[model samples]
Target: MLALLSLPDVALAQQKARTVDDLAKMYDVASCKQCHAKVYEEWEKSTHARSLIGTGRTIGGFQGMIRAGLMGAFTKSGVKDVGDVKVEHLAQCFKCHLPQISDATDEVARELVKAYLDADRATLGKVNVNCLVCHNTKAILHKWQDGEPEKGVVYGSKDGPHPDKYPAMKNSVVMKEAAMCGQCHGTGPNFEFPQPSQCATAYGSYLHAYIPAGGTETCQDCHMKKDGKGHLMPAYRDPDMAKRAVDVDVEARGYKFLLKAGDSIPTAVVTVKITNKAGHRIPDG
Candidate 1:
């Protein structure tokens, strides 16, 4: 079955017998404030809180797809009426972007994009690919939840800490695995990444002979960093996380004050180039 529970919510889900509806009920972003109130405050200021959900950053990538006439009729339902669709309809985007909300079918996804296009400041701007999309394990792409394996993600402690609200995660090996990042970072048509896009190929570098042998640094180690961002997976283009991962160097390049015809010859050509020396991949799924 398509995975419904995000990792954080999975921790809570263990305490109770969870159904799809139960998962939906418990996956409230508002509920995160119960324990992570301060982190929630930081998250509120961060772009992560608003990203795919149409709040902090522009969801123009997905939106641009629609404007470019990439949208087509759903093969399953044979529904082509784009005029009647709403912004809350896109399940494809919701599947990876908004894990909590249900009924995000292909038709619905089209509707959501359409709705976003037609929406004004009013209507609360239906939650587009909201907070749980990337951070929550539920939104991981091209993977299915294995029922037999102890389901859920745990950030702190091994053998799992007992949570009164939901499920308790026991083994955290999943957190350290590159597969964890591949859960969303890489994409395929259904299970493996089918397309040739950069988003789909993100996990390849981790699997190859380059980088480091047996590198255990998962995406979470760099982006999540146990810094209370939950699962926003911030990196690269991120305005905030980039600052924490960058350093600058300056050295004198044959500087000599020479007065040539009263023209200041004290300055020489100084070149500066920024490189992504530190930091790593972030899961976009």
Candidate 2:
């Protein structure tokens, strides 16, 4: 009992000593890319890479879109001054869109946003999704201490090299589950949209229907396959991928014993069957 009780105290002390930069180093994709060159190269071309920053029609992509939507919501709520819109109010958007920023508390987000507003474009634009955001197996273990991530632990799906150098390295099975992807994909009500909306309904639909129907495949199995290469989650974005997700068949039957010549024309019954071959409902999200 004494040993168990002391554990929390020890953890608290360690957490208090760490800074935001310490946690950032542990989660930095740049550091990770040194060893994971192949994975980094693949991810570089993926939509995930441009989640926070992009160009052309994809400028800032989803992150920019969410920010614009939130700004609109804030405007509607009487926050006429753009400067008055607090980063805390946009926490929900950061949760998934800016996971690195969201990993820390709202105060940290506020500080970062302030720095961003004050700094040059080249400096502020460095913010984006990092490795630990989605790949962290022990995501539940992540917590905030003094407006930064709790120190001494970094999680992933598989064991990594240099565990001795980086004591925070650890593996977890949860990273392999559909629930991991559902963290953002199965989002609920937030500041912008308070009502329950059809966001990423794949996981919910899978639970209620697919699981009971004896389905075992996870979101990764299909979305992270050949065309995606575990990074690009191509759905409607890729024409061929969308077509491959569902199987369709048409059957027709004609009545042999029809009515008289002038009577009602012989009718043919056509049946069209559509099967979801991707483990979730078609057109998810």
Candidate 3:
């Protein structure tokens, strides 16, 4: 006799036919974890992973900052109370903090923001930073188009299996360019600051100094590859990495008499020098 087996709910869900747009909307860091387990695990410990909640080094993350900004904007705009502040006004905050939601319509984004305002933790958690913001090679294309992604295109630095299913699986050189990071890290209007200012000017600084000085290395070379750890781009988080970027020295001159021999004290001159070995200026961005 033959035995019949039933598919699990998750298996059934995965088996359901989905358009590329639906897949893009459904995919998250957890989905990526199904295949790239090691990369997912490493990213789980990274600053990018905590970018939404502001854990680890990000203390009081983007959510807190956005709320503060909304409160201030409402106060300045003569809105009577925090409850009166419209969610639509605050939706732009998702661009960097929650790129997936940001790509959705303003109406959809407003609903998510409203959920957060209503103290719905589950809805807020859904908006946390995800994988595709960086890894998606067609991020630029998707970003500018303002609609569902092309039907069967999947962009990345490498080609994946099932090219017949995903026709846009083309290798992209932009993934390896410093400008790729500049999409977020480069100069941009400062949302947190009250006064107008450009935030995250690392790309501009690198171009102004590093490129002009005949430096050919990309940001990934120093931050990602220097330690042989792929995704953990250590900056201030690693003391050794920070130290490698610059050298410090101290020198003291001999004491000199400043007054009459019996009545005066001598003073010594101390000098401290810091030499930046990195191509760009120290404390970039």
The candidate that achieves the highest TM-score relative to the unseen native structure:
3
Query: Among these predicted structures, which one has the highest lDDT?
Result: 3
* TM per candidate: 0.55, 0.62, 0.66
Better of 1 and 2 by TM-score: 2
Q: After superposition, how far is residue 194 of candidate 3 from its true place, in Å?
A: 12
Expressed as tens digits, the lDDT of each residue in 233-272 for candidate 2 is 6665677776777788999999755477756666789999
Off by over 4 Å in 3: 1-27, 55-69, 73-93, 104-127, 141-154, 162-168, 188-196, 253-268
Q: Which RMSD values do the candidates have, in order? A: 9.0, 9.5, 10.1
Candidate 3 on 1-285: residue-level lDDT in tens?
976546785475455323323323554446566666877776777666655444442334433544665555435633343445443454444445555543444344445445555654444544445456665523443344444344454556666653333445544456777876666566556555333444566787788888998899988888778877667666655787779888989999977675875766767899999888775666754
For residue 206, model 3's alpha carbon misses the true position, in angstroms, by 0.6
Clashing pairs in 2: none
Measured on C-alpha atoms, candidate 1 has an lDDT of: 0.47
What's the ranking of the predictions by lDDT, best on top? 3, 2, 1
